[model samples]
Target: MKRGVRESIAVSAVLLAALFILPLLVIVPFRSELLTREPPMDETEGEPFVSGDLDSRTVLKVKNGDTVEEMDLGTYLVGVVRAEMPASFAEEALRAQAVAARTYTIYKLQTGGNHGSEADICTDSTCCQAYISEERARANWRKNANDYEKKVENAVTATDGETILYGGVPILAVFHSSSAGLTRAAGQVWLNDLPYLQAVDSPEEGDTIPNYYSRAEFTAAEFKEKMLAAFPEADFSGPVDRWLKNAVTDSAGSVETVEVGGVTVKGTQVRAALALRSACFEWEVQGEKLVFYVTGYGHGVGLSQYGANQMAADGADYKEILTHYYTGVTVEPYSFALPG
Candidate 1:
């Protein structure tokens, strides 16, 4: 070959060699980092990705009557946040409620709900979470309808498709109105000993909530009748002082067990029989009436709404509030697509 041609061929071979070796030199040392590197997450948005095609509809059976309705998940969540949590709550608190309600609804959908016949969930706060129609919610809001509705909708929108998860599964996401000063363990209130439902400090449940403290008064006859109805075998023939004895309570001052009329009974039984506000209570017999002073307003099993509001006021966002309430959990986007 001519000298010029030979030189050109040598240059071409060198270029080919460089092309073959360059990628290996750059990629081998950083292979692990590249493979393990997660996509850049939007700090403001939190989750890495949110599925747009996830099923966002649910069937709700309203307990007022036999009315059954289906609505978009976001819309249902707005109503739930309005009905379940006070509209006066901070925006971040409302957003936390929205995520919790969404997680609960999704959990019901995944696991068969209590209402087995026709609905995935119910509007009865006793059975499920309290829910109301948008019209009803607006009506209840009355003068504050427009602003409150906008606030609730904004909360739902801000945390759209977010849920609390443990071991990659949606959590039960139970919540209540308020707490005495701390939340209760799931096992303390119910049968299940859920790791994520453990007790946590909730110091923000101050006296601001209207129902934070309540009292129920019952005459001796009335109390006897109710208790006897629940525990028919109990002997109520003794004095009222001896009627209740050996009261055992939890760390949060919630009644756990008590001896009533020589029969052992759970505090839950007494609370249910008397229609008391919460299991955390103290009772005293005053002359002709037995009065129960209840410190909290609900079962005290999970997140406290008043506490969440206080945390939000203290500058914690929705995710932080949820993780604080639900121990060993993460707030993440719904990972699965709903059935068509």
Candidate 2:
């Protein structure tokens, strides 16, 4: 071969070798560290640090009495899971709850939470995620405390450092006690149209679950009084049936709008005015009282706890359950940097 041709061939061989060997050189050093690292500790009975690429030591400002105390993120989740869902639920459902709780906490931390304190979140279910101290939860569990604690801890450990994300950011992982056979889109229930919170069928929700159906009865005088209080301009002179006419509902059967005493009001407004369980309700007059038969519970805007349990019962894992409820979401290991 000519000298030029021979030089060109030598250069090509070197480039080919570099392309194949450089990646190995980069990865080989970390391989032993990756392989020999201890398996994540058993979280059932001890304070096992979360294993991930992100910081595991999250500090939570917890409101206890008038003073606030900082808590570990994992410990806080145990209490949150206990308050949010029943321990008797399937392990997968509990694991899903753990991830949702973590995602919610991080979201709140990212956005300024409504707690109005130096807290990342609150224990109040209405204000934020519900939580009970380990002592109180164990007390409430009574004879089943040990078993229940083990289950919740196992769930938290199994999904440690995991969160549901949309577009690489933690999402608003809102959840409810139950859904009306389907989850509602965020736009349908709220003013925002979050792409990840679209409506999805949750077929597992049905009459079999407790409080799948509920009734609230009020005397004509009482109903009239409540309506008048909410809508001062409401004309309550006619029969009760006419008062709640023209109920326009969304695709999920939740009352979106209705004519109450000649005033147009949203079903959510009616639910709040009457302390109803959900917007998915029907009202009727029986003799002298107004009766409301309500289906489902909670705001019906996110993962249904009962529905998740049913899915777990049907063999769906935590990842499947989370993805099913949160449309187009990825369950990925995440960690947030803690403040010094």
Candidate 3:
């Protein structure tokens, strides 16, 4: 009877252990709700604009930013890039750039030159590139350090979608540029057909071109003086207009034509016109040429991706960086799943 009791006790202990272990098995298969669910939408969408290809130029019209300007293809040519680039990447980069340039131009033309339906102020990095979190950047660096070549030959490419409705018009190849994490060729600051804004003395190997001054660059006194000196013609009641107020080049002065990598650019705005360069940024009037060292890149209208990355690294949140660049904007969801 005692032996029988001992066997029964041992069996009961084994059953208890099995019961405890069973719960763990169930827990092991169950993923956390946060991990399993789709991540919350990136809080960058305010006024959604479609970047599309019309005619042959690639273009984007943001809600509050400038109208869709034709993207240039020659800017990505092999010899054009100022950075030290690998020889293998030249052909692919050139080809991809050409295709994108042409596609976007077509999109603009098709939509009657618009990309946003409303003038909703953009408040997030969607109008530009998204800021990668510190942990994310570190993880990316670890995975591809010195070897993550976004160069066309090895990188995976994707289109935002084939068609997007910009201002209710159906457009083709309406996609986004540069993934949220990587800076693209579009981030390069350029003016005219030149990749680097050239100085009259000539550009050195490492000098930053197109250097424009930030508002902080000017003290209240210096700012007043420069504004007065720069535009003595009058009207200083508001902000000093730094960009091209009007086409500096007249109808006759504009480039009647432009050739990109042996292919001709097909838009009107991308003519071989005198675009502001380093000299233009400084507003220097030399020999009837508008010369000033310009700062930053692109149109100076959108989120500066490099600037955004720097801000992110400096511990500024994405919202702060977006607000700094895009004035008077609000944040919202900008998912591609929404029907246009």
- The numbered model that scores best in lDDT is 2
The digit string of per-residue lDDT tens for model 2 on 104-202 reads 988988887876656667788878888887678777987777788889887887888898999999999999888888888887667788989988888
TM per model?
A: 0.80, 0.82, 0.25
True-structure RMSD, every candidate = 20.7, 21.5, 20.5
| Stretches of model 1 off by over 4 angstroms after superposition | 1-64, 336-340
Which TM-score value belongs to model 3?
Answer: 0.25
lDDT of 1 by residue, 234-317 (tens): 898888877888889988788888998889988888999999888888989898788899988788877898899999999999
Number of colliding residue pairs in model 1: 0
Residue 86 C-alpha lDDT in model 3: 21
Kindly report which residue stretches of model 2 are placed more than 4 angstroms away from their true locations once superposed: 1-55, 338-340
Best by TM-score: 2
Per model, state how many residue pairs clash. 0, 0, 32
Candidate models: Cα lDDT each: 0.81, 0.85, 0.31
Q: Considering summed lDDT, which 10 consecutive residues are worst modelled in model 2?
A: 46-55
| Model 2 pairs in collision | none
- Scanning candidate 3 in windows of ten residues, the lowest lDDT window is 195-204
Candidate 3: where is the Cα deviation over 4 Å? Answer: 1-272, 278-280, 283-293, 338-340
